[model samples]
Target: MTKTILITGASSGIGKETARLFQAKGWNVIATMRNPDSESELSTLENVWVTKLDVLDLDSITKAVNDGIQKFGGIDVLLNNAGYGAYGPLESFSRDKILRQFNTNVIGLLDVTKAVLPHFRQNKKGLIINISSIGGKITFPLGALYHGTKFAVEGISESLHYEVEQFGGQVKIVEPGMIATEFSGRSFDFSNDDSMVEYQKIVGALMGAMPAMAQNASPSSVVAEVIFEAATDGKNQLRYTAGEDAKMLIANRQQYDDATFIGGIKAQFGL
Candidate 1:
């Protein structure tokens, strides 16, 4: 049987890898992005139908969903992978920044899920895997708001699993640690507001540690395989950690209670 899958934020990173992975595996891919033409790598793929979908725009989401269904018979899985990083301190972060986080991470995800529910209900079975992060469970000093959005994804995805059981739909969350993507370089899209400048000591340490952190993370392909496994055989498990780093991070999160964690963070940056 041919399975159809819809992936958002397919322009790059983990989403890009998943699009290619599934397409090679014989799955019909409806890959959506804010701008499709710019995604030459994805658009050139024979199995993927790259389309425009600005998650921030409700109508764009609706159109993309309809387009996916039109291109493929019906979507068997939907991977909500669209998101951006917002850095800085809570006090310094703008409400607009925070709101955009929720809007893109929470509301946009919910809208697309809602758009797909009826179709899944009609099909009698479907899967939804949301891309969360290690930060979702254990956050860092300056990542307050981005962590909040991931936590929201965790909460929403788990609960939706409960709500959709009667309808034969299942939901799962895939939390990944730092991967060797342009996530750090390109994903730092937030206004880099002078968030914790007052706490220069703490902030500087964290900043210095980032270069090392990026070096250690695995490539996006590792995370994509995890998503593929979860989507293929996700028997109602609520969450799957995408990489070994995520596994260790989640397992020892409690060991570094705030004080130790911050200390280690500072030590890395030579603070």
Candidate 2:
């Protein structure tokens, strides 16, 4: 069978790159995003179907899955890659902003996974690949909301594997460090209240460190390749770290205790 992969947030970044990679490798791709009408590139691909899927909207998620299955005969893999980074001091966040962060990143992922469970269960074999981040294992200043959601993703994927594995289904997590993508642009949300003078210093520190981080960022293609590996390696691996920085950070995290690891982050940000 020519296997099909359904990807979320495929309009740009790693999602778009992965869709292209899979299609080039002869796999059918259902490249979904919030606005499909604006996508011109993926829509032109032969085996790729560009569709609409907003993680915050359950109806859109379900419809995207069903429509992809119908178009490609059955989805063999589900790539939960639709999420953004929400940064800033926790105190600066509004109730709605907090909810939106959680809804789009954590809750939305669960909902999409739930919608696809039946299909995977019936097939008795499937792959669920989630795009977590290095932030999931290590925190940075002004990243409470983003890190919280990614940490939730890590836990969910790890625990969900236990349940799904019994029926030949597998769940995997891809932790990418910092890919050169538009993530810092349209996909990033930073909230801050300047009136809260206490947070200004840390905000300035974070802003200053960002440019250096961008300079070290690997291309989105790097993460896309990691996702491809997880999809096809057919190994029982639970997690795959993408990018050189991701590997180094994950290793350091494993080698350090809470205090040491946190101190290193503080030093990096000059906090």
Candidate 3:
């Protein structure tokens, strides 16, 4: 049988690359994004369907899932890859921005998972792959809110596994370090307020280092490959860390105590 995978936020970056890789691997891909009309290349591929899906909207989530199942006969995997980074001092963030961040990154993820649960449960087989981040486990300056959401994802995925496994469904988390993508550029939202001058120096220093960090980062295709492996590996593994930076950081954090890890991170970022 030709298995299908429905991916959210598939317009660009990791989501986009993952869609392409899966299609190349002969999987039917439902590439859902906020603006499907704007996508050209993915729609041109065989066994690939580009549809509109906004994770924050329940109707869109349900429709995207149904559309994929209808077109591909059945969906074998669900990739929760629709999210963004909302970074910067928490104090600089407005109430609306904070809510939006959680809505898109955390709440939206839960809703999509809920929409797909019945299908997975009824079919007795499915894979849920969440695109979390190294930030989910470790924190950095000005990433409190972003890290909070990813941590929520980690906790949610861990708990969901116990329930889903009873029905032959599996949940996997993909934690990728800084990748060279729009995620570091246009996809990132940085909070800044001129009135909060006290935090400017640290914030500026972090922002200054981002371009250089991105230069040394891995490509989106690398993370895409990891996602593919997680989907097809058929192992009971709960987490897969992508990129050398992510592997090293996760290992280093695990080897050190909280204080030591915090100190190491601060020193690395020159804080």
Candidate 4:
């Protein structure tokens, strides 16, 4: 029987590309997003079902999972790829924005994972691929809240792996660095305050350097391919880096002490 994979945030970027790649490989694709009606591409593909699934909405999460299973017989993989970055100075972040970042990136991911757990537990075989970031393992300026959410994901996935292993379920994290996607554009949130002139200057400098940082970034499709490997590799691999930059940076981080690693990041951004 052909396997099925359910992906969140399938309207664009890595999720969208992964849905296409899996469909191309003969897997049933449940390509979910917040506004399924607005999606024109994935909805038209064969073996691909575009459905509404807002990770923050528990009802939608359960509905999407059920809908996928109902249509495809069973879901073999769950790709938790719905998330966004909240950038800018921590002081400039309002209470709502900070909460929103955590709610969407961390809490929402957990909810979707919870919704799929029963099915996985019953099947005794399943894979969960979380679209974490290089930020999960390291930090950068203007990304305190975003990094916090990713770090939470890393820790949560690590702990959950042990619990699920008893039943043959697996968890894998994909860490992509500066992928060329709307994630750095429309999907990104930037906070600022006119009253905070010093912060404005600092944020401006950081934002200015972002384009250069992303110039050598890999495309979203590259990350999609990595996710595909993580899902099908059938190994006990817990973490996979998606880009050369991610691999290099993460390797450097592992080799260096905390102070040295942090200093390298500061030097990279001219901090």
lDDT of predicted model 2: 0.92
Ranking of predictions according to TM-score:
2, 3, 4, 1
- Preferred candidate (TM-score higher): 1 or 4: 4
Error of 3 at 53 (Å): 0.4
Kindly list the per-residue Cα lDDT of model 2 for residues 1-271, writing each as its tens digit: 8999999889999999999999999999999999999999999999999999998888998999998888888999999999999999999999999999999999989999999999999999889999999989988899999999999999999999999989999999999998886447677899999999999999999999988888878898999999999999989899999998889998999999999999999999999
Q: All predictions: root-mean-square deviation over Cα?
A: 2.1, 0.9, 1.0, 1.1
By lDDT, the candidates rank as 2, 3, 4, 1
- Model 4 clashing residue pairs (backbone): none
Report the Cα lDDT for candidate 4.
0.91
- Candidate 1 — which pairs collide? none
TM-score of 4: 0.97
List candidate 3 segments past 4 Å from native. Answer: none
Models 1 onward score TM values of 0.92, 0.98, 0.98, 0.97
| Consecutive 10-residue window with the lowest summed lDDT within model 1 | 187-196
What's the lDDT for candidate 3? 0.91
